[model samples]
Target: MQIKSVFIVEDDPSLQSLYEKILSYYGYTILGVARNGEEAVKMFVDFQLKPDIIIMDHRLPVKDGIEASKEILIYEKKAKILFASADKTIKDAALSIGITRFIEKPFDISVLIENIKELIDVKI
Candidate 1:
């Protein structure tokens, strides 16, 4: 099986490093990283082969996850984005925009890994 790829949109450096370490250990390729939502959208647009999943944080500078996900969906209607944020309020909104999943902040890293694996295993 081809290794799954992930694009991370997180502003916190520590969390970014943690995620890269854990996900890489699990055999997922880190496609790239984005510090904010606008960069996330731009990177998605520029990638020749889009990542299999996007780990998005809602409260981002420039655009926010919901907005960035919307913009991304316009370009790739079937984009699989997993909203990972502290904000619970945006869950419905993110789902409405076609995000594949939503996981609240401070979740277990194992859960996050499982979610990513589930997204990759399931046919879109």
Candidate 2:
């Protein structure tokens, strides 16, 4: 149950690119990167690419991460989402939706890697 495919929903271009490159280095195949929830949903549908895990930003345009995650989960119940955000309010919202793992902004990359590894392990 290796986590090979991943989808990242983030608005910041630099962060998005950094995530992509870092994850790729760790041997995870990137399914796609979406700047907003709407684009995320559309890309998920259009590609029919079901990623093993999703790393999502809580604050997004068109739709927030919580809303997008719920919508995505409606179709893919086993979807594992990791919420990454700077806002405490967003963390609360994510927790309300039963999201267990969250990474605060300005996080250490090593810490993120460990967290991501643990998340994938739990899902498997």
Candidate number of the best TM-score: 1
lDDT of 2: 0.83
TM-score of each: 0.96, 0.89
- Report clashes for each candidate as comma-separated counts: 0, 0
**Model 2: which residue pairs collide?**
none
How do the residues 34-113 of candidate 2 rate in per-residue lDDT, one tens digit apiece?
Answer: 99998887777676668877898988999988888888776777777888988866777786676657888879889777
TM-score of decoy 2: 0.89
Candidate 1 Cα errors over 4 Å, as ranges: none
Computed on alpha carbons, the lDDT of every model, listed in order, comes to: 0.91, 0.83
* Candidate 2, residue 33: how far the Cα is off, in Å: 0.4
Error of 1 at 121 (Å): 1.3
Worst lDDT run of 10 residues, candidate 1, spans 115-124
Most accurate candidate by lDDT: 1
Give the per-residue lDDT digits (tens) of candidate 1, residues 1-124: 8898999999889999999999999999999999998999999999999999999988889888899999999999888898998889878888988999999999998899889989887777
